[model samples]
Target: MITVVGTGTGAPLPPDAEAAVAGAALVVGARRHLAAVRLPEGAERIVLGPLAPALDAIARYFDKADGTEETDGQQETYEEKETDGQRGGRVVVLASGDPGFFGIVRALAERFGSRRLDVRPGVSSVATAFARVGLPWDDAVVVSAHGRDLRTAVHVCRSRPKVAVLTGPGSGPAELGAALAHRSGARVLVVASALGDPAHERVERVTPGEAAARDWGTAVSVVLCLDESRVLAPVRTVAGPAAGPDRWALDEAEFAHRDSMISKFEVRALALARLGPRLGDLVWDVGAGSGSVAVECARFGAAVTAIEKTPDGCDRIRANAAAHGVEVRVVHGAAPTVLSDLEDPDAVFIGGGGRELPAIVTVCARRARRAVVVAMAALDRVPAVRDALDAAGFACDGVLLQSSRLAPLPGNVTRLAATNPVFLLWGVRPPARTEGVPQ
Candidate 1:
């Protein structure tokens, strides 16, 4: 049997785990974990660096006991041997924190079926880090940047108030801090390093700027990115992000806009539905005139970047975002060129594109993982936009929104004030088609 054990933050191993370790014929784990645990003099030890070799060795050891050699890439299992005064066929894999949570237990289970393996879990690093900070973590979002892209973690810190980032060599506190340095909102980055090691355990709180200035060598384990103001929210109904905003597609008057430049509420509601913004998603609002769409998406718990050409428009977007108590990264530059540096988006909303409408739509469609929604005031541009989306392998659909609001004239009489019509075109990437056998 393969037993996966969690060593919680340098604490002494539990009695049951200790007995397992003592009886293990093969103990596999990191150098640190192996050193901490005592093993029988006759036990074989494997220091986990690249895990494949160790896994192969473990499988071979078991196969030898069953008098069978692996061949043709096929798996073989062995029956437990009865040895006097000892457990002769036990294998133990050591891990940090909870073995089942983003740990090596998954690898072990995949190699050896779950029925043959047992898991012993401990407190996760995220839990330990929060404990060190004296904060409750039920409301926090946990993301890992270990051997994966850091963009998602960065975006989570950008939009959410509380986040615990599991750091790897290149994607640690400094990298996280540098990414948030230019954002409008303030964040406190708690760098927790060498967790569980009494001599090396350290939790340092710093601003994004301060964090970027230093090199926090490689012992770091996790970083807690927090917006201090909202760290403790009113007793939550549900955990993680609050239930979607009480209201969305807010009226234009709620936002600060210039000369009625904001997209009508009707258009925004459809765009939002198509965009389907949610936690862990990054949405781009290219040509974010009043940032109405950006603000709304942020309200729905998506990270937003508002790209506008004019400096004034960027400022207006920021003001509207702040007024709504949300964070929106406003980039003061034109699209297609400026968009090259921005992170790829899950969904995109294009409110204005000037003569570069088709080009902008092409770029957005190429990068957007879900859907691209575009609003055009000019009737002549609809066909070009549609063509651009079609070229990008998107299923295109559109509607001309012409709404009229009730206006009070005189003597308690109301009249329908017609608003300018806008063509809303959206493209959804087709579900991947599967091939069938020929008849």
Candidate 2:
């Protein structure tokens, strides 16, 4: 059996965990964790670094627990021997905070089955950081930038009111702050370092710009990104992200657009389908005349950036977003040029770009990680759009939609009013596909 202890949150070692450590034939942990606790003399110690090597070391020590060479890489299941006044496992893995919460417990459990592990979870760093800020975290989004891409963390922080980011080397506060400083300056970052140690523990609040200006060393435990305005939300029965919108493709009248300049509900529905907006996603709405597409995408819980060339259009987008209770970063610039400064999006929606539509689509398709959707009135642009998507290695598909809505004439009579035909095109990255596009 293997015993995993979660300790770094200033909690005293549990009595059972103390006994486990005392009898452990092989003890594994990070350097800081090892320094904090006293191990039984002569117990083999493996300082955690690259996970595979530590797992291998644990396997070696467990294989020889009975002092016999087990033929296979199996641990000898001898009857429990009493040590430290109790029976214990042959291996103990020490981790910071709740090892079960994004810690070593998963790796250990996978190597040795859950049946072999006795997990003792402690307070996670995320919990501690939120406690320090005196905020209720049930509504917060916690993302770990440890050994993973930082863009997801930035995107979540950009859209959500509360976020907790677990810092790692190269992906720490400075890097995260730099990424968010320009785009998410409205949010605040609380950097907590060396949790559980009274003498060395430090927690500081700073703007993304302030954090970007400093060199936060290796002690950073976690960074809490918060938008103070919406920190408190109504009680949530479900955890993680807020629930996705119950409905989408809102009617044109739902948005305050200029004389029906916005993409109609029919076209917006199919565009959103191909875009597949969700939490932790960054979506770009280029040529957003009324930002109706941008507002709808934001409602789906994605971080949306609406690129509009006209100053008035940008204002309309921002106002429309505020009215709908969603955050959308409106960039008052044209696509294919302003797009260079913005982060690559998970998806892009290009609506009514005129002759520049194909060029914008090419640029967006190249940078979009998942898919791109374009809406056009002219069939002449179809070949160029298809070529752009194909050149960017996307599987291109499209549909031409013509719809009619009920119109009231004289004497309580209703007649179908034909809407202009629109061509909707989408290109998805290979092998991955999402559901639902309107006819």
Candidate 3:
């Protein structure tokens, strides 16, 4: 039996939870987590500083007890596959704050069954940080940069005026500062580090560069209040796209690209249909030659991620984002590989992928909330891309886009100039079935 307790750092554990830990035989947690608690004198204490090593020790303990084969780094899988209905042993895992809120409790729960484990949660560090600043957390977005993606932290700050990022050594205030530095506006960055410890420190209203330079103590959470000198308008209390852009889809010449490289407005209209871009949604403009789709999505208040391969193309996307006066995060690199560490997107629109289109389509279709891929050449690739999306559980569909524009002839008479044919392939994720299932 493993009992997980949240010490909540500076805050003391609740009466009932403290009693639970005092009665436990084996306790597992980080050094800080361990220090926060008052353990019984003879309980076998396991310091969980390095995750792999600590999990190995747990695996060994369980192996010896059950007379089963020993596994090291695969403790969670081993426990799940081997454990019968019997109680293994008395163990306690401690974390900071409410373990359920993006805390160590997830790791523990993934390793051990929730039924066999007892969780005694304390006040979440995120809650404590917000409380210290006298801010309500109901609408706050809580993200952890602890052994996970920092892009979420960066993107949240980019799109939202207020965000709370749980920071770690590499993903601390410095990293956030660096991401924020891309924008020129001043931000009121509050770093709350070591909240409950003796060396607790809180740095308020520091500039991005200064926050980057400071040596923030352990277990830091950053509250960034964007001072919107750069933002033309304040975020409206009501969520969703601001009603300003007169049209949903604009003309083909709306964006600057290399001689007809932009996705045609007609095609973009259908792509948007598949994309379903809306407020609070995150969209990706993969192979974003001119960032046209991404810019449009951002216009509708959907957070956009524009991925481009060429250096010149990346520069164009950035310029386009700034020109449109919307926050569209631009990532520079080739598709599929460059897409490695990005946040899961609500929708993805591929515009320039060639043979790599299928693989790119496959990856995005599997991960994104919806996807659309467009290609001008390589007619053979369409079947493969459609097949990939279908295999990845998307409801696959496509359309061929052909457009003609009237131009003045030698006599000043208008003549139709045919544009190159382009194929638009799209898909959407089927919503979960709630029709017959009891809640």
Which prediction has the highest TM-score against the true structure? 2
Q: Order candidates by lDDT, high to low.
A: 1, 2, 3
Best by lDDT: 1
Candidate 2 lDDT tens digits, 224-251: 9999888999999998778888999898
> What global local distance difference test value does model 2 have?
0.87
Q: Model 3, residue 62: displacement in angstroms?
A: 4.6
The TM-score that candidate 2 achieves is 0.92
C-alpha local distance difference test of each model? 0.88, 0.87, 0.73
- Tens digits of per-residue lDDT for model 3 on 284-306? 89999999899888877677889
Total colliding residue pairs, candidate 1: 0
Of the two candidates 2 and 3, the one with more favorable TM-score, higher being better, is: 2
Per-residue lDDT of 156-212 in model 1, one digit per residue for the tens? Answer: 899989999999988988888998888638899999988888888999999989999
Query: C-alpha displacement of 293 in model 2, angstroms?
Result: 1.2
Per-candidate count of clashing residue pairs (backbone under 3 Å)? 0, 0, 2
Task: State the weakest 10-residue window (summed lDDT) of model 3.
Answer: 75-84
Off by over 4 Å in 3: 62-89, 184-186, 217-265, 273-292, 299-399, 402-439
